[model samples]
Target: MQILINLDANHPTFPPGTLDTRSRSLMETYIKERFFDNLMYHEAVQKDFAVWLEAHQKNSQASPKGKRLEIRKIRSAAEKGLNTTTLLGEMERLHFDARNNVPDKQINFGLSHLIDTDFLARMAKQAGNPDIPITQRRGLMLFGATLMVGIRTSEWTTARLISDNPPVLPGETAAHPILVIQTAKTRKVDPEPRYLILEGFDRGALGMIEACIEMTASMTNGHLGQLVAGMRQAMLRVADSPEAFELIEHIDMRTARKVFTVESRRDKCSPEAVSAALGHTTTNNLRWYAQGDIHCERLTDIPLARATLNAVKKVRDPLADFNERKQLAGGKPLSGYPDLGTDNPNADLDNRGSASLANRLINPQGNR
Candidate 1:
């Protein structure tokens, strides 16, 4: 409301503080008039939707996830003689900001390139291509497994694949395959391992995880980081476009973990269930990772509605220019100006550019 009032030309100017009662009243009246006008509001909707979408994108891009990822990279760099003090200070500030500030929570950030089914499928296809390097194929397998199970970067070495109980039990349809992951970032409070049921994924997804486990059987956790890096390069080789390449370039464990949580929530799983899958002992931390369905739907659908409405041109105010011209002429009528106020009601759309492009194109003669 305050933003709307500040944007209005006739709004009263005041110091940088709370709005006065008159300003608030004017803002309310403006909103009511805009809502009740009932005549097509395409122009206003387009303008407002553009502003809102830009702001949403900006906030999502500036999310704490980016900062945390950067902090981790810098800390890792410091091990090889990047300034340790500065890195530690930055980490501390990140923690402080997270606690004190309201970070931008993204909505409907599901099924993106970072964790899309098609992207995974393409990588899997590349894995099976004998022409591709065996090392690249191995990395792709590990990449798909990490994304599907949402394993932490550090947990790659500790993650173990355990088959369902009585692996070959006849007609055990309820039996679910398990992936055990040693929890990271527990700060020594909750270091217990978490189990993920692989029943949610299909046989193809299981193949990726199985292949990854077989390849890494002889390697230690310390070697897994380099393998993950190789996966990023493999992803680049398969990316079909520059935008896909950019998103794949920033692929990290956090992105995969977020995808897991969101996809789980999309399946109508309770918050507690999703939190447990994420290895969180409580649901308190879920807010940073995922939002409720209503918020996501509202934001994701706004642009869709805006695109459909944008085909029609803006509605012109016929009296606006005439009134301005009259005011300039000392509130007297111009000599040659025809009074548009007296024009026929049916002809109102004539000079107003109110006819939709589809209608105009279909009936060039303007009969219907």
Candidate 2:
């Protein structure tokens, strides 16, 4: 799939002595037209599925088993593609490829859709209001939590508050709340569940989540999923005013997540810390969203930095002795603890043996 997207018709291959300018021209024209057609089809398919899903949802109760099956099939099929998996790397790389001068705007990563923390605080306050409709309350909570904790929309179906036995950090006397959620896109590998610790300002986030779960308790899983997914648009109807409404006009779940990612890094949080907060097993996603170090200070004088520099400088090129060592180890890399030998200054044991061993060798007073 990526190969098709990256095809370069300008460099066409041909057999020896085969001079065919017509074939070369034909290939170039075909590739140009093919990309255009694919782009159009992608756009059309998205619009078609959205319309179909809306219609199906309106007639959900009245829709027959066949219609329901079709709706599910269409939704699944629309989401299945290389684009989803390659979003963080391969697709992003295509934009920087010199061969294709793709404009930065053409690659929509949603990194610029930053939501104001003040606005999020306002939504959080609204989420606690009991006078509003339950749906509206849940919608606000959904939006707030996504921005606060970086919860993916799909994970909402399985998200729940697990405040029991909150782990207390060092020097902290009281335990804080925790939001337990299954990491999305990782159920296949049975990945460990992620627990988001809610402390200080974020302590109320768990309460709002609890409220959302309590109100939707009786709802079926399918209905719950639908309601949670709709919160992206439903949130606007619950907005406080024209300003709040306008703020979220172009925002979706992904955009909310992007705001969280960008804001976290902007606030000087470490990339590894942000990745952990986002429930990612690695910093790969963090790199894609934030890209590069947020803090640019070069601290080469620090102890660790000096130690690392010294260690790196001491490294000998393995290729220099490759030929001599290759046959000695049957072309396999040798593995063992290098510091255990006598050459190590830190090792307690030496070639002569330990002081205790020397003491025993003296046989206490004299040789018995």
Model number with the top TM-score: 1
Taking the tens digit of each residue's C-alpha lDDT, what string does model 1 give over 179-222?
76777877777565665666655666666676666677677665
lDDT tens string, model 2, 141-213? Answer: 6655566667676676677775777766443456666666777876467775666656543435556667655
User: Between which residue pairs do clashes occur in model 2?
Assistant: none
Cα displacement (angstroms), candidate 2, residue 42, comes to 44
Model 2 segments beyond 4 Å from truth? 1-114, 121-134, 168-175, 201-203, 215-247, 291-368
Write down the TM-score of every candidate: 0.49, 0.41
Local distance difference test, per candidate?
0.51, 0.47
